[model samples]
Target: MRALFLSEPPFHFGVHEPAPDLPSRIQALVDAGDREEAVVLFQREAVGLPDAMIAQFRATDAFAGVVPLAQSTVYDATLARELSTPTDAMLAVDVPVTILCGQQTFPFLSAAAERLAAAMPHAELIISPESIGHRLDAHAATRILAARLA
Candidate 1:
């Protein structure tokens, strides 16, 4: 299924580091003429994750592009909506907007989901796997989701 994944950073601060950190990332991306792409709202230092690990991120293809942001939804959506194209709007026409949040993204998940669900025709929260040495649960969730699509 085609999807749009958003993660509220800060919880996984141990996992990612945004290239520009939210506000700047948005500014840079928009300034760089990337308003028509999907941005990665990571939770920590993103540089740490290996390309093999994030190979699933087809932001350059599955998405128009990738965005690494900090923990600010205001900043997040501002860039998201502003740079959005008509086709971008159509992308969510019938596609499921799956928010793969982590266990650490607590109450914020609910609130974020609430906003996202309202904004998109299709959007739901799927608590990602626990962050362990191996992304066992994350992989499990991925397989489970894949099976659902199959």
Candidate 2:
């Protein structure tokens, strides 16, 4: 099995810092018809992606069809609220788990991946240097997963 940024209930990963009001800010940008700025803000603040990665992402078809402001805002808000609840299901998994993360991702994400791998008896953490921000290196992931399966 494989996972990315898995956290048990009450997702406490990062240092003690107040969460930024990202959804509102993004919504405002979108509402103002500054969709490009909204994308930049989302990449920088929410995803912690570097400028180069952000530029590359902006060129993608997925970026062109990013969700509407209202839906995105609601989703982000709900995700924040939901992450606070605790669950023990993750700890019960018995299969070998490969936790993959990008070296350039948010520090908290890397920390969370590390912690999850540490806690899981059959888990391994792989931080791919070729990855950008929260994006995975498809080639590297394919190679690793294939090797594991074999």
Q: Which candidate gets the maximum TM-score versus the true structure?
A: 2
**Number of backbone-clashing residue pairs for each candidate, in the order shown:** 10, 1
Which digits, one per residue and each the tens of the lDDT, describe model 2 over residues 34-94? 8778767765665456798778878888777773443464355446545532245765577
Query: Model 2: runs farther than 4 Å from truth?
Result: 1-20, 48-81, 84-86
Can you write out model 1's per-residue Cα lDDT over 49-71, one digit (the tens) per residue? 34444455444363332343223
Worst 10 residues of 2 by lDDT: 3-12
Clashes of 2: 1
Error in Å for residue 109 of model 2: 2.3
lDDT value, residue 92 of candidate 1 = 58
Candidate 2: C-alpha lDDT:
0.63
Poorly placed runs, candidate 1 (over 4 Å)? 1-92, 106-110, 129-137
Clashing pairs in 1: 9-43, 16-44, 16-45, 16-46, 17-44, 17-45, 17-46, 22-70, 39-67, 40-67
lDDT of 1 at 69: 28
